[model samples]
Target: MSILSLENVKYSFENTNILNGIDLKISKGDCVSIIGTSGSGKSTLLKLCSDLISPTSGSISFYEKDYNSYEPINLRKQISYCVQIPYLFGDTVYQNLSYPFKIRKQEVNKDKIIKFMKKLNLDESYLEKGINSLSGGEKQRVALIRNLLYKPEILLLDEVTSGLDSQNAKIVQDLIKDLNEDGVTVMWITHSLEQSESIFNKRIQIEQGKIVKEEILK
Candidate 1:
């Protein structure tokens, strides 16, 4: 079944259309990449799916239910959104990882957190280090782990690996591949055609807010 469906979606700001009649479907366990030049409504499309902004016209559905039917917070929890530059909070790495659970009134699982960190090539000792002391790559890894700790049904990534070095970028890419293999639907926006070809099975190209092509790659 399709996890996400966008039917004739349209968006605009002050009457200037940004997205025009976009129709797309993304299935569970699929790694789909949306590629376009900057200002081509790539991020806007992600925001629309996450219900961060309402579409000007048309419908968006998740798991066959209209997006408007779900509670905002509930929808956000089930569909985690990761941005290009991650934002980290709290004094230490451990505190940042535990923040999501803490806000949800749940106990933090240290072992699980550590395991996720290891998957991203982060050592357990880094947990006690202050967030301010880490580099951009470290912050991004920690932010990503925090998002995945609860295992959201779908992850919306917006140029998530753009800020990483080659080594760290490989780690993030591998983690994304692992998540898709484990049945998490991923809708990612990227400018790198090479990365798109390597990491995603489906590609949707957008130009001037319209879908110009949708290709399924082996």
Candidate 2:
């Protein structure tokens, strides 16, 4: 089934086009990657998909429903975006991890958090530490776990592994691969051509604000 669809979508800023007549259809549980050079509107396309930015023309739909019809908070719960530079709001990791539950007025899932922490190579003791003490890679992993606790059907990632050391990068890469294998849809943006080639089942290449090609790997 089609989980998300963009039809003739276009976006512009100050008369400069970012995306033009872009059409994409994402199937449930399908892994997709978006690739293009910098300034090619790859990030812009993700923002549009996540409803962070509205298009100048055309439409985006989720599950055959118009994007604008759903409430923003409710929609975001199903489509999560994890950025490269993760933002840690509170002072401590526990506070950050509990944020989702706090906002939802629900109980925190400590068991699930611990389980995911292990899978992401984080120790339970780290959760008690302040965010200021964490390294860059640690912050990124925490951010991912925090967002993923809700189990969003579609996970949007932007250069998720860039700039990290081999170990941290490998931990993230393996974790995400397992998530997709377990049936969470993933769409990511990456600069490494080799990473893009190796990870994605289908790659969409954009150039000059247009989808130039779609490549499916073996």
Candidate 3:
């Protein structure tokens, strides 16, 4: 069975249509890369899939159940969304990293957090640094680690590597590929064609709010 499905989904805002007739199915461990020009409704589509916003028409289902059937908080726990411009809260990196555990009433796993940080090329000492002191790439890495702490069923990414340099982007891409191999469903939005081709098993292109092309790479 498909883990997530969208049937003829349409979304509009302020009287303007952003997405038109989007139909997608994500199975377990499918790595989908979304590519489109700016203003092509890529981000809006991700938000809808993550349930941050609802579609104007049609339906979305998770595990064969309607989206509205699950509480927003509970659904979000399984469908994690990482934005292009990450929002990090609290004063220090540690606080931001611990927020996920705090919300779930679980103890923070410092070792695992450190392990993810290292994978993103962040040193252990970064935990103590003030959020304001870090660069854009550093903040993105911290936010990503926070998202992975609970190991969500589906990870929705919007240009996650936009703030990183080439080397750091490659590191993040490798980590994402590894996670998908471990059975995490990933839907990523990226403008980088090279990155899209290199990491994704499936690719979709959106143009003016419609899927213009779909390809299977593997």
Q: Each candidate's lDDT (Cα)?
A: 0.90, 0.89, 0.93
Q: Write the per-residue lDDT of candidate 1 for residues 1-218, one digit (tens) a residue.
A: 88999999999999899999999999988899889988889999999988899999999999999999999999999999887788887699999998888989989889999999988889899999999999887888888998999888999999888878888888889989988899899999988888999878899999999999999987
Q: 1 or 2, which is superior by TM-score?
A: 2
Per-model TM-score, in order, reads 0.94, 0.95, 0.98
Please list the Cα RMSD from the true structure of every candidate, rounded to 1 decimal place.
1.4, 1.3, 0.8
* Residue pairs in candidate 2 whose N, alpha carbon or C atoms collide under 3 angstroms: none
Candidate 2's TM-score: 0.95
Q: Give the best candidate by TM-score.
A: 3
As for lDDT, the candidate ahead, 1 or 2, is 1
Question: Any runs in candidate 2 off by more than 4 Å, and if so which?
Answer: none
Q: Model 3, 1-218: lDDT tens per residue? A: 99999999999999999999999888888999999999999999989989999999999999999999999999999999999998998899999998898888999889988888889999899999999999999989899999998898999999999999999999999999999999999999999889889978899999999999999988
Cα misplacement distance, residue 113 of candidate 3 (Å)? 1.2
User: Which residue pairs collide, candidate 1?
Assistant: none
**Decreasing TM-score order of the candidates:** 3, 2, 1
Off by over 4 Å in 1: none
What value does the lDDT take at residue 169 in candidate 1? 85
Best by lDDT: 3
Q: What's the residue-level lDDT of 147 in candidate 3? A: 93
